[model samples]
Target: MNKLLLFIIVFTLFSCDSKNIEQNREYNYPASKVWKHGVYSKYEARDLEGVFDGLEVDVIYSPEKNDIYVRRVVADTSKNLPLDEWLAMLKVPSKMSYWVDFKNLSKANAKQAMSIMINLLTID
Candidate 1:
């Protein structure tokens, strides 16, 4: 009887702790796209355009004008280091990816759009 009781007690404590751990990670919203992806800034927007020199700007995804906006991840230049600087400092080689996949995508067009997106989106 004591052994059975102890087993139940241990199981209960383990289940309780696991429940709390899972609940702690539940957040109210989807993670920000800018925060999760797009490694560019507003300042970089104008400058980076030069990286993709001679690219056209057009939206592949659009339901509304205001609905579709440039998605970007920006460094708090004053506080956070610039993206290029961070890339330079990394001890190990790393890569960052930006995307431009809409409902209808042309590989060539998407490539160009991604270029514009990278150049235009800012931290604000």
Candidate 2:
């Protein structure tokens, strides 16, 4: 009986890992399980800096459940960043990630889908 109970507890602990989206692009996403999900599109892989900041996009892949995080870099530090430092951080592989927004989402369903993130990000 004790052995069975121990197994059950271990199973429960690992079962809860799930993915959630984060604002901005900073994330701890696992390697692509399916490469893409959600309302993603097939586009050329773009590996560039400054490009990631321009739009609110639906990522081709999202980080692990709630593991993704986005925070504002204190603007004052943006300019002082050394060229090498920035390149190292942003210079990742070029792969087909997605860029989506409510503008492209189906209008009939947009009203409901648009509010999905609001609920996720809400803290009461």
Candidate 3:
């Protein structure tokens, strides 16, 4: 009888611990998983840097420049920020990662875009 009681107590303790761990994991998930999309400007990124774990910006591949730029439309490429410049402005936390929403990432531009992105990232 004593052995059975001891076994029950240990089992109950272990079960409660596992349940609390699961709850903690779920509660902490959103803080790290939350993403802020359409963050195109420095002001927007600055405002949201603390509130979100990830900031996603729309980028278009500029064939003329053979580079990626942070902008929704290709028509106004003159005012659009270069992807590297946009990236440089972001003082992102170590927990955060770059999330570029490529508006015109095709097979033709993918290689060059990737290469450019790689260079930009490596420079940081």
Q: Rate the local accuracy (lDDT) of all candidates.
A: 0.37, 0.34, 0.75
Arranged by lDDT, best first = 3, 1, 2
Ranking by TM-score: 3, 1, 2
* C-alpha TM-scores of all predictions: 0.21, 0.20, 0.66
For model 3, state the Cα shift of residue 73 in Å. Answer: 2.0
Per-residue accuracy of model 2 over 46-110 as CA lDDT, tens digit each: 23332433222332111222211121232232233321222234334222232333332355545
Alpha-carbon error at 92 in model 3, in Å? 4.1
Best by lDDT: 3
Candidate topping TM-score: 3
lDDT string for model 3 (1-124, tens) is: 9999999999987777543353334322345767888888877776776788788888898889888888898886565788777766667544456578888888988988888877876644
| Candidate 2 clash pair list | 18-65, 19-65, 20-65
lDDT of 2 at 65: 28
* Candidate 2 global TM-score: 0.20
